[model samples]
Target: MTSTAASRPGAEHNGFTGRYLLLLVALIWPAQLLSVTGLLAGNAQSQIAVHFHTTQIAWFVLVSSLIGAFLTPFVMRAADLFGKRRVMIVLTVLGVIGDLVSALAPNFAVLLLGRGVAGFYAPIAALVFAIARDVFPPRLVGPASGLIGGGVGLVALFGPFLSGWLLDGHGWRSAMWFLAAASAASLVLLMTVVPESPVRQERTPMDWAGGLLLGGGVSAIVYGVGRGSDWGWSSAGFLASVIGGAVAIIAFVVVEGRVAHPLYELSMLSRRRVWSVFLATALLAGTVLSAGTISQLLGLMPKIPAVSDGLGFSATKLAWIGAPASVVIILTAVATGWLARRVDSRYLLATAALFAAVGYGLTAHFHHTVPQLMTVGIVSAIGLGMIVALVPVMVIEVVSPAEQARANGLQNMLQGTLLTVVTQLFFVMMARDGRVVQGTQFYLDAGFTNAFRLAAGFAVAGLLAVALVPKLKRLEEAETGEAAR
Candidate 1:
């Protein structure tokens, strides 16, 4: 059953203070580095192509997504092994380096590497969620985690606007400079403000073999799925990568079964209490994680005067178009995050899934005009806010304090892997009937319809997944029981 770590002495603060606010900001800043970087690239694909003389603009974001999927578990393990604060400092440095590299890159190759390194910042979100749980009392955990979860709304509202403004005024590289300066400031806060996590695991041998195997398997699968569209879905190369990845993952499990010190606690993960959430996570991937990217792409695609039915808006224009939805998410995320402590997460997830299905179904047919897509986006934002606010809370609450990072980290890996595959699937669906336009490709309206339909279908699948989750109680009960002992 779902539960939170029992409250510790002196951790029972009644309200947050300025120090707490500063801590949360320090925790969220590094994560925003990744978000702003991706939005910068995603919203300015056309500009990147013109500036770099290449058509593979999506790679700028995809490479980072792949690295996040591959590296997060190890990073989280390192945090638990060392200290969250120390690891966060190192990550901030890495992210700042990435920001500088991307900003000053003379060629697209260097930019790609820079973005991939920035993906190392991906684990910071999970770290923030875990840290809030560590520092806050049981009563405050849900709302605190919710705010951490809602940090996306903070970035989404501003990232697009800032990226668009920079893209319009100073060019794409200038945005990276902004991220670099912001990251440095964040680094100082992490070094000074955020406390190290108190929950610690006993020292043990590092599971290098299992880590390599797991990373390799996950990396192979993500890469194969991402490239399947261009390499032919049934091509020999695609099959080899997929098969190899599966073999490696299976072998990793075998090795974990026999290891003295496992990279992940497989026995713990397989518990019904935990595994159900992971299943829900996989299904949720197809919902918000999949549909979100599709919506962004459709919103930003260049509108061909007489050739295509795409919306030819610049980053700034697209950001304005999406502003209504961002505001809705900010409201819904706070509400759902608060509700998570009272209502069962399964119900929250179910409601979120249902809303997404309806919004995507509407998007399938009525997406030629601004009002139509805006309506779909606003409707879908309710679900987006729910997933962002509630899912992370559910993930960390299911385990004890010591296992929190590994549990959250594993979920990130699962979520990141599935997101990469599912998003690529949507890109492939729309790209099936695409045509070349001035060295770039644009999908037909019919292709977009098919992809939107598929997105709705995934939302329906998520609803089924949520139905299988058992009801759980508030964290306060768990704390009460611990106090009586």
Candidate 2:
């Protein structure tokens, strides 16, 4: 006979139940929407540049991506120490406040500050993954996590179109206003529906030194890479930032090894399989970020006056091209989760990398028409969807439940750092040798092609790393046994 609901060991906890997994997935949408607000406003580059310097456009994108990355480890640690639900609510509220700040900002600096504040929302996905592992049944974990992965793509399907509509109707600020309202609504639902995690790590003092060193190191390195083309690769500032950042990172590693209750366990890095996954994930992260950025730039770039360099599509037209790819991402992510139950995850991951490589290759060489671009996008989305759905499950399989949040956080940190570096490289490549047309404010066709090629190279690297992933049947069986007990 089936056991009664009350008989379930952890069912009585007031936390988000299995029935509410969809709500948890829904809560993540606002953050995803808010994160891409800058991308949605790509058509307004000239208008924004009129108010702020052209360089600030890059800063606007960089700040949001970097700040959230630097804060993810801390936020994940907080979620582990405090409660995931509590921390999520706080972050969501902050996201709302950030949207409002951006919406009402009188100047570019204040808007950047607002975007930086919104960066806190970046780790919400890790928190949700942790919650799914804690709250859902073992059988449901993959599907639940898949939904979280897919939800991002699902929202992307609509976000651009909606933002474009709003931008065309009102103004650039209208998108921010929409983000604020959406974030507020999501915040309310999160508070009312999601329950606090029952599990909490014992409180430990915050690792201020580690945080500072790591943040400074990452920031310095990213800055160097980002500005290397503009300032000259051999410039004194570039040398100082890169070299200093490297030293700081080494020191940070040494510190992590020595600290009790460290931000991340050094021993985890020693495992070949684990490290391989991390490396592969980092490459995949770079691929996704670079590809997405290139796609947006290509979509918004005006056609060359004498040459067929760009499609010169409106934001709405670009959204329609992107929307189908988003749907494919969602579907593929969900399918990957279903497949993981039967197939080895490493193969799935490797396939993901392969898809990315092919997609980027196609875009680099043959993207002249809208249909070609859309085809490439769909191909890349498949790979991205698989990576998103599988990586969390793979991490969970390898680590104990207690360490899941930190593991995911560390994964995010690595991915974010790599993405920052890769994005800088993309900017450098695109901006090389007067790639931007004077006064037209659009990139040369070669810029987009070179960036896409770079993305393909990263995907190839990811494939190599994924190939090193040890077969996890033994590990999976062991975890399954432990869960059965």
Model 1 — TM-score against the truth? 0.93
- Runs of candidate 1 exceeding 4 Å displacement: 1-12, 305-307, 478-485
| Local accuracy of candidate 2 as per-residue lDDT tens digits, 128-205 | 777666655455566666667666676568767875687666777877787788778778777776655555677888
Summarize candidate 1's per-residue lDDT along 115-210 as a digit string, tens digits. 888777767766777777776656566677788778778777877788778878888778778878887888898888877766656667778888
lDDT of each: 0.75, 0.72
lDDT of model 1 at residue 422? 75
Worst 10 residues of 2 by lDDT: 1-10
Q: In lDDT terms, which candidate is top?
A: 1
| Per-candidate RMSD, Å | 3.3, 4.2
Q: TM-scores of the models, in the given order?
A: 0.93, 0.89
